[model samples]
Target chain A: MHPINRRDFLKVASFGGLVFASGLSGCASRAAKSEADEFYFVQLSDTHWGFQGAPNPDAKVTLPKAVAAVNALDPQPDFIVFTGDLTHTTDDPAERRRRLAEFKKIISELKVKDVRLMPGEHDASLDRGEAYKEFFGETHYSFDHKGVHFIALDNVSDPAARIGEEQLAWLKADLAKQAADARIVVLTHRPLFPLFPQWDWATKDGEQAIELLMPHRNVTVFYGHIHQEHHFKTAHIEHHSAKSLIFPLPAPGSQPKRAPIAWDPAQPYRGLGFREVEAEHDEYKLTEYPVVKA
Target chain B: MKRRTLLLGALAAAMGSARAEPEVIRIVARKFVFEPAEITLRVGVPVILELTAPEVAMGFDAPGLKLNTEIPPGKPVRLAFTPDRPGEFEFVCDVFCGSGHEDMGGVVKVLP
Candidate 1:
């Protein structure tokens, strides 16, 4: 084996922490004591239900396969969250609706109970998620679960997924309702901080959203857009991303353009699937399981 | 060095050439995305995408092609297919990473 550089090791460790464990050690142990709030959620991102292409010849079948894998999880997630890319195009309403209808069909095939969703640019591209709202709900909103404050934002509404003053204000009031010590978990289609602005990954007003979240004692954001599991911490808040259910993209800066990653036929279906985020109180652990774990 | 071996090799090459494919589009990957967002190739020819991602672990799924595949971090993936018709087919990342996902796409324009 080659020698692992400290930088790479730190990166690996950081990704391990984000992809698998909550960095704060104390919080991790704390979760063990509070079984009442011990809850888990499944992250399903970038389904792109209507997509068809060269990367895979069986995309139509694999999507449902991923959902089936999620449904087969042992403990069963309290709820399932779909981050974005529900469809492939932004301009075609008929395509969007057709894709969403297929999404609904596969989701209906889900053995799991509750499925929460946020719009990705592909789903909201044409009209800033106007159609998505009619199907899902408000673009951005909040809810509470077992003393945990959970908020979902609509950042992919515009070209840059601008959080805007309205959503920012809502986030502020939403956080104000917390007791200061309450652990907050946020969900959005885009990363809460600037991840890769060049690729339009960062929300234009993500900083404002981060500022709204900064006041909380324990803050973590779950998002999907990049198509892989990556996490970052800014201003004391942690931002974690989920993998897509459709195709995988190259990392930021590594390539000139972000497009569907192609694969060798012999070893196809290697790097895709769902992740399980389990937590209690301020601590959480995420582990991504490729669809075919064997 | 050997006359018999040379003749056999030449004959094999000829047979291969006779059945050679008319078209194939190749794709390359670096860190987190595809290199060519759009590719054009002759009709009825295979589109061979050379997929790659850096050391960071990631997976790949092509919903359109009915392909659910993974790109082992720090390696290469090559996908081949023949698009019988000409149009734009979209591919989205199946892995859960943030930022450039919805933007991750490519097109194959098969011309007559």
Candidate 2:
């Protein structure tokens, strides 16, 4: 919540080190100092509310506990974004709506007033996001906050795991409005690049989306379908995946099948948690925190 | 002249049989895989893919061949298409079936 100062600038610069180590340009430091745009947000993804099984026995309590965890943050987050998969998939239309309503009711308890929501394949693909839209307005949209342009994409709704042509055109038009050097953050459920297509980890038309975002100098993508902490890069655009609230999945192609890792009673909620992304100028400092610290 | 006429009639019958019936390939989809993951076909031959998902509703998406369809549980969905070119293509279960849905895909090889 505080503005970027010398200490924060140095902290960000230290990660890369080259640009600032040679000589801290006055122009760069001045831009970091003057702008009150420094802020951080919480990213909670893949809650899977209706999911019940061996992968996560404590599924009922996970979402609520996550809500309490986010509320306890010291400065709190500027906003909270639920990347996707708010609820598990279901064949029954009525049950699907029920899960969405219940999931919404639970997240409503979060202390953060600004909470953003999107749909994962589990929440949208079955019915083409019809039930999900009944609860959450639009599957894809864009907004701006504190000098950062945030774009929430809906790659899961189409079932084929594509962003669709209509949405792609919308993205192109939206990017045209922003400056070339704008700081943009993309939020979605599945990875835009083919992390592992065999496991449905990659979005079908995600390459086109990445191409659209390529022109922008500073662009960071945050997604959650893999249900683990995974990092990838397509050119300069960095893609970071958030941990799931319900269960953790195996590393991409680590095994023959893409099944959920069985829950370990000794370490309940081991790999389940959210993240805090602190933005300072074009640099982002990511802090990973456990759901309840094991 | 009678012998020549008979030969021409038999040739016409053979061509009709070749073009009238398409080859049927049955593929079973379950959990996170297709029964016959890898399939081979001849270019210009019409084929009908009989798809069925035993447990959940799954999708058959062969983007390379522009063939996409939904296979509901307990019911069979038939998709007919003719292989237009000689090359390898990929088909995947576009629907999210379970934890391993991402890996539910196979390659289609077409012979020239």
TM for candidate 2 is 0.77
Give candidate 1 regions above 4 Å deviation.
A1-19, A24-33, B1-112
- iRMSD for each candidate structure, in the order shown: 11.6, 4.0
- Model 1, position A160: C-alpha lDDT score: 37
- Candidate 1 chain B: 10-residue stretch with minimal lDDT: B93-102
B22-112: candidate 1 lDDT, tens digit per residue: 4444454433466676666666766566666664433444444554445666677777777666655555444433334445655555577
| Chain A TM-score values, per prediction | 0.89, 0.90
Give one digit per residue, the lDDT tens place, for model 2 in B1-112: 9999999999999999767878899999998889999999999989999999989888888767888787889999999999999998878887777656766888789999
lDDT of 2 by residue, A81-139 (tens): 99999998776789989999999899889888899999999888878889889898999
Query: For residue A69, what is the lDDT in candidate 2?
Result: 85
- Among all candidates shown, the one with the greatest lDDT: 2
- Cα lDDT tens digits, model 1, A163-212, are 78887887888888886557788989888776765455667678888877
Docking model 1 quality class: incorrect
User: In candidate 2, which residue pairs get closer than 3 Å at backbone N, Cα or C atoms, i.e. clash?
Assistant: A198-B102, A198-B103, A199-B102, A199-B103, A200-B102
